[model samples]
Target: MLFELIKLGVDAFSSWNSNRSEIKKIKLENKKELVQLDHELKVAKAQSQIRMAEQDQAQTYNLDMQTTIDMAKTYKDEFILIIFYIPMIMAFIGYQDEVLKAFKSLDLMPDWYILIIVLLAVSISGMRGLFKQALELIGSKFNLKGK
Candidate 1:
């Protein structure tokens, strides 16, 4: 009976030690993840600052960017540009799943409704300046107006 009890105790001790070792491994993995997350957060902050500086530089040089800049500085332009560029980027990057996930999370109004409201507030006639600028850009690109 004593020998059986000693064997059982040994088995329990071995199991407990294995569990402790596993816990230690998991804790080390969690600590590593925390360090990686801290580095990622720092990188994200640096990227945000760089993006803001780029927006400031663009505003200084680009007159067409003035409207979006004046309205909400970097944020408005960034939101619009994100909507425009992210899908384009994702298509090239092969991240269609992320785009679909974004689409699924949107609980907003339909596009046609937003279109009608925008047209009323910002008419096509109001875009003449933009149209002129685009024409000038194309003309300059083709050297249509004798440089």
Candidate 2:
């Protein structure tokens, strides 16, 4: 009976050791998983911060552009209008011959030079889409062989 009790005690100790080892291994696996999750969370946070910074930069750029446009709005159009009217005033003031000569001289310039002037005028006038339409019209007219 004593031998049987000794054998039972030994079996119990063996079972306990095995269970303890299994628990330790499970705890190690859990620790590794937690470390991986921590790394992923840090990476996600960094990416989010980067995106927020980019958005802030974009907003600042847009605000600056809006402010500049607003400031220019006060005098840009008026100045352009007055400059354009100067030619008309000169024509009315008995300088029609000079104005005609100036325009005729411009006709002698290169097509590219004329295109540049037109583009500059269109941009200053804030005439969006007109440049493209003008190009298309000019292209179509030039392409016509007879009609």
Candidate 3:
């Protein structure tokens, strides 16, 4: 009877040991899966943050571009008024004749003076057009808000 009891005890202990080992293996697998899940979550969170930052940067850049476009348009309008309207007003008021006569009395050659005037007018007009084109190019490149 004593021998039988000893054998039963040994068998029970072996079975318990086997169950404990299986439990340990299951727990290890769960821990590994949990770690993997945690890592994936961290990566997802980081990607989201990066996307948010990029979006914010894009918004800031767009705002800056819009502001630049607005400023350029304002400057263009003001310059146009100064360059064309002011001259028109002076001519309408009959000040152009006096001004031309005063400049003519300076003993300058008529041909050279005319050439100089033509050149200056052409240059000013060309520069104004070029500035407008440059502003348009910049607006297009930067996605600026403008008409």
Residue 124 lDDT in candidate 3: 36
Tens digits of per-residue lDDT for model 2, 47-118:
999999889667656655564586475776677688778878999999999989988998999999998876
Highest-scoring model, lDDT: 2
State the displacement of the C-alpha of residue 20, model 1, in Å, after optimal TM-score superposition. 0.5
The per-residue C-alpha lDDT of model 1 at residue 17 equals 100
The weakest ten consecutive residues by lDDT in model 2 span 124-133
For candidate 2, the TM-score is: 0.49
- Tell me the tens digit of each residue's lDDT in model 1 across 1-147: 999999999999999999999999999999999999999999999999999988865654464455534656335545555666887699679988887777565537688876665544332223434555676899999999886
How far is 134's C-alpha from truth in model 1 (Å)?
34
Candidate 3 per-residue C-alpha lDDT over 1-78 given as tens digits, one digit per residue, 9 for 90 to 100: 999999999999999999999999999999999999999999999999999988966765665556556655456445
Worst 10 residues of 3 by lDDT: 122-131
- Identify the runs in model 3 with alpha carbons over 4 angstroms from their true place: 75-147
Instruction: Write down the TM-score of every candidate.
Output: 0.42, 0.49, 0.47
TM-score order of candidates, top first: 2, 3, 1
Error of 1 at 32 (Å): 0.5
